[model samples]
Target: MFMKTFGWSFAISAVALIVAFIYGGLEALILCAILGVLEVSLSFDNAVVNARILERMSAFWQKMFLTVGILIAVVGMRVAFPLLIVGVTANLNPVEAIRLAMEKGSIDDPGSYAYLLHEAHPQIAAFGGIFLLMLFLDFMFEERELRWLGLLERPLAFVGRLNGASLVIGLLVLVASATMVRPGKEIDVLISGILGLVTYFLVRGLGDLFDVDNDGDTDADDAGALAKSATRGVGKAVGKAAFMLFLYLEVIDASFSFDGVIGAFAITSDPIIIALGLGLIGAIFVRSLTVYLVREGTLDDYEYLDHGAHWAIGALALILLLTISVEINEIITGLIGVLFIGSAFISSIVRNKRVTAASLPSVDQLSS
Candidate 1:
C-alpha cells in the first residue's frame, strides 16, 4: 500500500534530481534534495491536518487534490507566486521577474529577485501567520471528544462557549504582531494580517454555507465540526462544500509554505531548483503521506495525532509572528513541529496499550 501510494512521488523526485544535476551539476542536485527534505520536515504536521480533512472529501475531489491541486502548488505557489511577489514589490514585469529569478541576481542588491522577496517577507509572514493562527485558534477553541493537552485545551474550549472567541483572539494576536513590526511597516503588517483573517473567514464561511446535507441538515459550523459533519454527507460532499474544503486546504497549504519559499533563497536562488525540490518532490510526498494516513486509518488509530498537529501549527503561527521582529533558524522551526508530533505518536501508542490491557481479564478474574 505504501509503495502504491508513494511510487509516483519517488519517481518524480528522482526525475527532478536528475534534472537538477543536468541543469547545475552536483551542487544543484544536492540543494534540491536538501530543500525537498526541508519542505517535508516543515510540513509533516501539515500532512496530518490535511489527512483529517481529506478523509471527508469524495474520491473524485481526492484525485483533484492530487492532480489539479498539486498543479497549483507547483506552478502557482511554487513558481508564479514567488515571481508575482517579486514583480509587484520590485515593480518588474512578469518577464522581468522571470528573467531576474533565472539570472539568480545578487541577493544583496535591492532590485534583485531574492532581495525583493526578502523585503516582501513581512507581509507574507503576516498573512500566513494570521491564517495559521486562526486555524490553530479554532482547533483549540473547539469541543472535542479527545484532548491531547486537556489541562490547557479544556480551559480554552470552555471559553470557546463564548461567541466568536477565535475571531476575538485572532484580532488581538494580529494587533500585537502589527505593533511589534518595524515602525514603518506597521500598517503593512496590519493590512496583511486583516486580509489573512478575512481570507480564513471567507473560505470557512463558504464551507459552512454549503455544508447542508441532502436532508437539509447543516453541520459545518466551524473547522473542527467540518470533519465529522462533512463525512456525514459523503455522496453529496462533491459539490460546493467539498470544493470549499479543497480551497481551504489549498489556502492552508499555501500558508504553511510561505516561510519555506522565502527560506529556499538562502540555499539557492534558482527558482527551477526550488520548484523541483519544494513543489515536485516535497509537496508530492506530503500529499502521498496524507493519503497514506487516511487509507490506513492512522489518524483514528492515533487519536492525539490531530491534536499534536494543531499544536505544532499553533507553535508555527507564533513563530511566524515572532519572526517579524526576531530571526529564527529554519532548523529550529522544523524540529519544534517534529517534537510535537513525535510526542503525540508516543502518547497514542501508550494509550492504546493501556486500553488493551484494561479490556483484558485479570488473572484473578480469569481464575474466578
Candidate 2:
C-alpha cells in the first residue's frame, strides 16, 4: 500500500534530484533536497487535513488531485505565484520578473526578485494567515462527536454556538495581526485579510450550495423536488461537487505553500530549484501521504490525528501572522507541527491499548 501510493513521489524526487545536480552541481542538489525536506516538514499537517476532505471525494477526483492538482501546486504555487508577486509588488512585467528571477542576484539587493518577494510578504502573510486561521477556527469551533482535548474543545464548541463566532474571531485576529505590522502596511493587511475571509466563505459556500445532501431542513415538497433532481442529475451533481472540492483543495494548497515558496528563497534564489524541490518532491509526497491516509483509514485508526492537525494549523496561522511583523525560522514552524502530530499519535496508541485491554475477558470469565 505504501509503495503503491508513494512510488510516484519517490520517482519524481529522484528525477528532481538529478535536475538539481545538473542545474548547479552538488551545491544545488543539496540545497534542493533541504528545501524539499523543509516543505514536507512544514506541511505534514496539511496532508492530514487534506486527507479528511479527500476521503469524501470519489476515486476519479482523487486521481485528479494527484494529476491536475500537482500541476497547480508545482507550477502555480511554487513558480508562477512568486513571479506574479514579484511582478505586482515591484511593478515589473512578467518577462522582466522572469529575467529578474533568472539573474539570481543577492537577496539583499533591492533589485533582486527575492527582495521584491520579501517586500510583498506582509500581504502574502495576511492572506495566507487569515485563510489558515479560518480553517483552524472552523475546526476548533465545530461541534464534533469526538473531542481530543475535551476540556478546551468543549468550551470552544459552546462558544461556537454563537452565530458567526468563527468569522468574528477571525476578524478580531486579523485586526490584531494588522496592528503588529508597520503602520503603512496596516491597510494592506486589512484588505488582504478581508479578501482571505471572503475567499474562504466563497469556496466553502459554493461547495455546500452544489451539495444535494447539504440543503438543510426542507419541506416534503422541496425534499421531493430535490430527490427527483438528484435522481436525474446525480452524476452531474457529483462532478460539480468534486470540482468545487478540487478548487477548495487547491486554494488550501496555495495558502499552505505561501510560507514554503517564500522561505525557499533563503536556501536559493533560483526559482527552478524551488519548483523542482518544493513542487515535484515536497508537494507530491504530501499529496501521496494524504491519499494513503484516506485509503488506509489512518485517520480512523488514529482518532486524534485530525485534532492534532487542526491544532498545528492554528499554530501555523499564528506563525504566519507573526512573520508579518518579525522574522521566524522555518525550523521553529516545522517543529511545532511535528510536536502536535507526534503527541497526538502517542495519545492515540495509548487510547487504543486501553480500549483493547478493557474489551478482553477477565481470567475468571475465560476459565468459566
Candidate 3:
C-alpha cells in the first residue's frame, strides 16, 4: 500500500521538480524542499483528520481520493488557486502575473510580493482562522454518527435542533463580525464563512444519507444492492460526500497554505517559486502524511490524537477570528496545535502502558 501510494506521489513530485527546474533553477529546487517540509509540519494534524475520514470510505472512493483528489490538492490549490488570487488582487494579466511570479527572488524583494501580501494579510487571517476554528469545533463537540461522512460529525446535532431563527442568528453573527472588523471587506469574509458553514452542513447531510448501519447483514448480494442503492441516493444528496470531502480538504489546505503563501512574499514574489516551490514541497508532504495516517490507523490506536488535533484546529480558528482585530503569527498558531496534540499523544501512551501493566499477571503470585 505504501509503495503504491508513494509511487504515485513520487511520480507527481518528479514532474513538479522537472517543471520547476525548466522554469526556474537550483533555487526553485531548494525552496521547494524547504516549503514542502514546512507545509508537512504545519499540516500533520490535517493528515490525521483526513486519514480518519478516508478509512470509512469505500475502496473505490479511496482510490479516487488518492488519484484525482491529489491532483486537485497539489495542482488546483497550490498552483492555480494562488495564481488566481494574485491575478485578481494585483490586477495583473495572467501572463504578466506568471512572469512577475517567475522573476527570481521577486517574492523576497521588498515592495514586491511581500508588500502585496501585507496588504492582504488581514483578509487571509480572518478567513483562514475562522475556517480552522470551525473544523476544530465540529470535531471536538460533534459525535461521529455518520459513517459515509467518516470523521465528520454533527455539530448542530450536538447543540440540538437548529431552527430557521438559529440559522439567522448565526448568519447575523458572521455578518456583524465581518462588518465590524473590515467593513469594506465584509462581503469577502461573509462569503468565506458561508462557504465553510455550507460545506460542513452538506458533508453532514450526505453522511446521514449514505451511512449504512453495521448491524445489517452485509452479505455479498446485500452489499452490492446496498451500494447500488447508495450510489443512486448519493446523487440526489445535493453535495457528494466525496466532493464535500474534497472541498473540506481544499478549505483546510487553503487555510494552512495562507501562512506559507504570505510568507513566500517575504521570500520572493516570483509566482513560480511560490507555486512550484510550495506546491511541490508542501503539497507532497501533506498528501504523504494523509496517506500515512490512513495506513497506520493512528486515530484508532491513539484515541486522543483526534481530540488534540480538533482542539488545536479550533484554537487556530479562534486565533484567526481574533486576527480581525489583532495579528497572530503562524508559528504561534502551529505551536498551539502541536502542544495540544503532543500532550494527548503522551497521555495516550501512559494510559496504554498502565492498562497493559494492570492486565499482566504477576509472575511471583502465579508461582506462589
For model 2, residues 130-184, the per-residue Cα lDDT tens digits are 9999998888889889888899889999999999999999999999999999879
Q: What is the C-alpha local distance difference test score of each model? A: 0.88, 0.87, 0.61
RMSD of each predicted structure: 4.0, 5.3, 6.5
Compare candidates 1 and 3 on TM-score and give the better one.
1
Q: Using TM-score as the measure, what is the rank order of every candidate, best first?
A: 1, 2, 3
Encode model 3's per-residue lDDT on 1-368: one tens digit a residue. Answer: 67765776677667777787776688776766566656666666677677666654455555666677767766777666666666777887778656655554444355354455556665666667655655654444444542222343344445534434334544665665586575577777777667756655665555555442122323352354345446324221112544455555555666766666665555556666666666765676667777776666566667767767776676666666666656566567667867877887887787678878999889997898
10 residues in a row with least lDDT, candidate 3: 231-240
Candidate with the larger TM-score of 2 and 3: 2
lDDT head-to-head 1 vs 3, winner: 1
lDDT of residue 127 for candidate 3: 62
Candidate structures ordered by lDDT, highest first? 1, 2, 3
Q: Which regions of candidate 1 deviate over 4 angstroms?
A: 212-236
By TM-score, how accurate is candidate 3? 0.73
User: TM per model?
Assistant: 0.93, 0.92, 0.73
